[model samples]
Target: MAIIKCPECNHEISDKAPVCPCCGAPIADHVVTCPECGKVYFSNQTECPQCHHLTGKEVAAQADVHTKPTNVHKNNRIIIMVVVAVALVVCGICYAFYHNAQSDKEQIAYEAAMASQDADVLQNYLAMYPNAPEEHVDSIQSHLEMLKAIDRDWTNAMVSGSKSAIERYLAEHPNSPFKSTAQHMIDSIDWSVASAAGNVESLEAYIESHPDGDYVEEANDAIKNLNTTTVQPEDKLLVAGVFNSFFQSLNARDEEALTSTTSPLMTKFLGKSNATRSDVVTFMHKIYKNGVSTMKWQPMDDYKISKKDIGSQKIEYTVVFSAKQTVTHDDGSTEDLQYRVNAKVSPEGLISEFNMVKILE
Candidate 1:
């Protein structure tokens, strides 16, 4: 190895030497050097060993001594860079993942901004990255088209008396992300349109189709304002059957059966003034004991559902009942009975109310 000049002094020193040994200078330190005494000293020393001269170079040189470790680190970094490059070649597939991850982040931001009605922000993002992924370009175009269409539809629905324009747009863009919003707008408009036209059939159909729609209550309110209407003939059958059974039971003196046929409220009302089960038993017992068992019951004709009213697809049917009954007592005494009955029927064929009157004959 070639000899190195001592940094502490201007003395030639052997490279492997620990010190100069001539002036007791630390030659291997390569740091502080005496300017006048031609002596070397350790880098931390503040004076020349031979001449006792103060020197600041020792401190500066000590501060710089750590730089040699950095050169080794630099060389190590070169080796690491080479390894990384080789790894990239061995796993080329990782690059695609990196690209897709970055693209997804951009797409998420663009979609979020668009949803928040920030069209300018979205446009700026698109302008900055005009050449986005091919797969995302078509989606972005479709979203932009939907936004424009929705704005136009809102304006048309506001100006026009109908929401048909909005409905048409939604039908055309059924696959669009704004389809649900378009549907909501159309449903809102349907209520006003149906009400203006007094189209009960259409209103009922719409309510049936969209049970949980926002317009359901409003459409029903409109239906309730319409004049009362007649119920169907088939529904009248159930009303007549139930009333006839009740009338027959009353005439036959079957108090238990009659009570069973009447509603709970009607039963409670009748109990205050009418015969109980014991009274019916005593009457039957007396008739059997006397052997005067002539009892006749006849149902009246021309019974029908009348006084109808309709509201929000519900129908109310008012029915009339007339009947006659004759009973002979044990001593051949006879009694003739005549009845007039009125019953109210609900939309679902359940009886709501009934009143009976004894007609004098």
Candidate 2:
């Protein structure tokens, strides 16, 4: 029998043996050298087990073919490889052209939508193509330019008091992209319309109704500047001081102090009926025992003095009050509170109409 060697360990074995007895490597097979590591192994393996390098039967086949004559089998394999490579290159080019064509179609649609000045069409295009390309920028710029013109026309209509056109336009196109801008334009018209109409009552009422509206602050400022009734600075300060004194008197629960400052109208307004000095003192004692500590008052910028009526025999102005108070309980815990007070003063420097507004906790 012919002796064979194991590829893994070079152990010798009989040619008919299935495995080498020394290293347990299979021996009953044809083996080849691994090109990367020069290690001999079974020809069917694609990688060398020792070096882990890729090797294939193709390399061995090509080597065999080179050793033989160039013939029909060799020519056929070469033609087949060339045909497959060309087909792959053509497929790549076709895919690129198809993608480019689709992109061009979308870009043209975006431009056409903008040029038509139809907001619906533009929004639809944007929805369909959220990732717009660089080419869409020019169309967007043109749309912005058209919107600027519309804004100019809207502003002029408001200034010239011909707001009907803009109003009708806004009503007709409520869902227009410029709806927020149109609302601002309409408010500007409201300011001019309210002022030019010369209805002070309506103006004040409108301002009061729309406290946080866009026109509220501007309307208030206009009212302050356009006020025809003027009060002496000294009298304005005195009335404000008197109201403060009255609040302090009430806060301290000092009946004598409150009675001295209050007039007959104020007494009635405070819901007191025919009470003299002694009775007031007794009532104040009871109130002081039951009531919590009176909170202090601080002034705020929104607090102001305005005449209730213009140029009447009865001079009148409003005295607005705002204050932040810290109330302490007997248990030594304290809480902060804020108050807003509005007082309408008569010619006699008395608070005729006193209204307490919201409290903030």
Candidate 3:
């Protein structure tokens, strides 16, 4: 070993020492002695600072060759360099293989999550692969949020059990995969309501609204039976037609046709006292003038008043109907409304008395 001075305390020490035993200073790495000034400094320096002496190549040439012949020293150094280089290459290969295996596993899990199309599975993937690529993480998060929103909307629809609620879901999620299911829910609900009413007009309304619905055939068959079936106390088919005509005329905004659907002796109209046909015509015309562009009856089914079934030439019936009207103004804006009415077609198949009912969803 060569003699050298400690950098911190200037005490002499062996080159192979780990620390300065005399001064207790830690030995620094890659240290060397300046031959000219006998000063010790790190091997990375090119010169001695105390005497301003520049170091020559002799310092490096003699650094590791002092104990052996020149040729053997050179060969030993070459072997050691080759060994260190090979160790570095092996380390790089091992690390690359480990990184690739991790990437493959992550890819497999991501593909499975996408295939399942499940929200929970995607959430787990995010928690597991926090260091995943930016694009993949963004796509997964977006899909998961959409799935959650769809579930929430579906839950609300089912809990409410209302056609409007179900329809709102469809409207909000136009491109949803549950499109067909939501539409079926609406169709089945309408069919059930029509069946419960058990009237020719209600079934007819269902057929008109959903021509391609699942219950179309059944509704048509029901209507055929009601047309031919003898309804007690009064002709149900004929009386329902009178109520239908009244709305049809009202939609057409034809005042004369609307007046014809009523009786000359019509004394009670829409809870109005001693209201005449003229008064009815005037009131309806006022609504039309206000901006009612179209009036549509939603679904109608009438119940015949069996207690008042006494006349031969005329029949009295209570009609419960729902309607919708659109109001459009000159400014190109529009409003839609739900309308309902409970009225009686007093003798002569004319609407003599009427009452407005609460609007429905």
Instruction: Please tell me which model should have the higher TM-score, number 1 or number 3.
Output: 3
User: What stretches of model 3 exceed 4 Å from their correct place?
Assistant: 1-73, 104-117, 134-139, 175-180, 197-361
lDDT of 2 by residue, 208-274 (tens): 6556668887777766654535455665676767766765776676666766655544432324444
Clashing pairs in 1: 8-32, 8-33
Query: Model 1 misses residue 280 by how many Å?
Result: 5.4
Residue-by-residue lDDT tens digits, candidate 3, 194-244: 989988889988988899999999998777655444354446675667777
Candidate 1 wrong stretches, greater than 4 Å:
1-118, 125-150, 175-178, 189-208, 211-239, 246-275, 278-320, 324-338, 342-355, 358-361
Q: What's the TM-score of each model vs. the native? A: 0.37, 0.31, 0.38
After TM-score superposition, the amount by which residue 272's alpha carbon in candidate 1 deviates from its true location, in angstroms, is 5.1
lDDT for each residue of candidate 1 in 1-361, tens digit (9 for 90 to 100): 4465665455777856865555444445445556887665555556766898876664657746745644564677688889999999867868887888878888886667556444456566677667877655666666666667766766665466456766666666565555677677777676666666776687787788678888898878766544345334556576777666655665576777655554443212222333344443444445333554666656586577664546565767777768677777777888888878666665655445655678975
Cα lDDT computed for each candidate against the true fold: 0.63, 0.63, 0.73
Residue 261 displacement (Å), model 2: 12
Ranking by lDDT: 3, 1, 2
